[model samples]
Target: MKIATKKIAACAILALATGLFYQESARAAIPIQQWKASNGAQVYLVESHAIPMVDVQIDFDAGGRRDPADKAGLASVTAAQASSGVAARGAEPGLDENALGEAWADLGASFGGSAGSDRMSFGLRSLSEPGLLAKAAQLAARQLGEPAFPEAMWLRDRERMAASIRQANTRPSTLAGRAYAAAVYGSHPYGFEVTEATLARISVNDMKALHRSLVEPCRAKISIVGDVTRAQAQTLVNTLLSRLRLTVPARCAPLPPVAEVAPLAAADLRNIPFESAQAHVLMGQPGYKRTDPDFFALTVGNYILGGGGFVSRLSSEVREKRGLSYSVYSYFSPGLHAGAFTVGLQTRPDQARQAVEVVRQVIQTFVAGGPTDAELQAAKDNLIGGFALRIDSNRKLLDNVANIAWNKLPLDYLDSWTQQVEKVTVADIKAAFRAKLQPEKMVTVILGATP
Candidate 1:
């Protein structure tokens, strides 16, 4: 499945709101147990014996947003080579990282991670065997601290990234997302792309430097769910992550301030000739930051606008009323900084313009009058009342915790999520939305618009 630019945009944006809703059916307060590992890593453990599997993640602050201008792909390449067997380089260091990653994967476990705009993550899902868990975690920690970004592996990964870059040009949604990010995050690392030139410039040393400077115990938050106690989780994190001498003081960078983007007046149309019957359109601008006081209000407001699926105004105007599209939705993505507040739809190519107009009308109307109290109440009830299904599994809980860890949100953030949603009065939602999103200034990217 070749995911498009908008899909990637949606994926990246949705990850930020992973813990937006609270699952009240947790019955008992599923405490977010906190501890400091001896190695300086903060650990959050949720002991859930509900399942026979354990999900653990070691997240670091070394995401792509911190990549230096000279070496745009350093953080990304460092993240990619995290467990990809950095052993092709000559000697013991190479062998160590490769073996470490392999060993972690060998014990009936699956491993994966990604570097986002503000954080990088390494996750493991394994059978709930403490001994096996110990080995896997230890291996993960080694991969974290001792990554030897070998010349050969770095070159190979760069080539792979470049190949994907070449392919993205022919993908409408990919191009749209890149354009949107470039337009919104201008001159910031948030807009950086892993292009052929950028990837080529990223040397093995750049990756090494990034891993050395940023992948520290201090920048780490390890979350363990299923079959683990607070003490055991702490020991696991310490034993695995402590040996690395990571004394780099925290260097905090302020988020890229919200940019004043102009409307897409003359559409920068592009063709990615495909046989699919419909084209996808993604519109809007950078949304809210995770720590923004109005995050909850914007979220609830967006739910009423288009995030409520069939119940949303976008769906009502663009799909049900006008029959211009199959689906239309809008959402607020609160990230480490301000994320994208996007409104998107996929429609038959012939009706694309009409669909876009319908969406605009809905947004403009909502912006002018805001949601009525009836609409506001419905969104809160659905979002809050339906929160339980979100925490149904250990993996889900880990996702919530990982997002919180990435944003350094309050430990009780999840517990207070429903309340936050409830506290969003009609006025709160309107003020937050009006302050965060400007319908007139929003950028719209319509991929594969029909002639």
Candidate 2:
């Protein structure tokens, strides 16, 4: 039975990876159907009958930002343990982790939970055949609402995670990233590190309390893509959330607001000694939030700066001309609050200083003068040309729909995405960068570098 279950799970994964489940159309315009569920959950759907599979993602406000200072990994652990087991309900017997795994394998479907900086999400992927889909949704609903939070499993997983953390500590990149986050984010929860001590403070009771408080049906944003119509998607969502124990509120109350990420008041520099062959360097400061008006400008500007691979100015100056590092990159991680804008690279300990200097000069120049006409045109062209690949699959399209639901973006956001990119001018890029990034006030961390 175990061998058969393993074979079934492997075949399911293979089918997903090989595109045996869905097909993509060349149509650029994706019309999103948006409505509120009877449970007060926001529903976004992109119906595609080209294939017989459906992908659904439900997101809530429960994420790392809500973690208590002492229990830094609470949200992450809660999401992970949701599928460890489902408690027995009436005559229905409880399913242990092993039993749950076998059940999903038997159905050739997948469902799981994950938490990020801003949201906790549960996703489901199953064939849209009525019988198979109904069974998969029922199982997922049970796992979502009835987690047992078994103490033994928590203890076992905690030890494994601690061991992994110890291994990660030996890596220079990990040390550099940890130090950089602390320096950049200061006391923000975004900088909270999951230490063994923090994990020790997280009890099963805490997980249960968090799940009960935040996983209310009224707070969900459900995004669905694939071979389901509006009526069918509504039914799937209703089943998936039916097991939630909390009553639907008269009106969903807003969660307590988290403090915004504090901007850097002054530059922070850290140098740590290690015996590694290469030095890890990270630099940057707080960036804009997801809803910031400068998002489009920043997105285009970043491509020309460091996000466009070999075509970026950072690559041209730091790697190609100077030969200081094999790869150097920069990015902005915008979330509910301001996220970090980071520039990162690795090089010989001696060349680390030179690489850092080159990166700084390139950023300063770009922010002050902006991209030239040729650079601006190239970035727009690349972004617009490659936009189709962004929604070329069911999973990717589902993610975009989820983003729209979460961020309260317009229904036509995807349709106008290219137009937004095309209209961003050099002046727009310069002004946006100047407004958001502060090179002088940035945090810089260098580990395993020479004195």
Best model number under lDDT: 2
Q: What local lDDT does model 1 show for residue 124?
A: 71
lDDT of each: 0.70, 0.89
Model 2 TM: 0.96
User: Each prediction's Cα RMSD?
Assistant: 7.4, 2.2
Q: Could you tell me which 10 consecutive residues in candidate 1 have the lowest summed lDDT?
A: 1-10
Show model 2 residue runs off by greater than 4 Å.
1-26, 248-250
Question: In candidate 2, what are the lDDT values of residues 208-252, reduced to their tens digit?
Answer: 999999998899999999889999999999999998855545247
lDDT of 1 by residue, 412-438 (tens): 887888988998898887777778767
TM-scores of the models, in the order given: 0.83, 0.96
What's the TM for model 1? Answer: 0.83
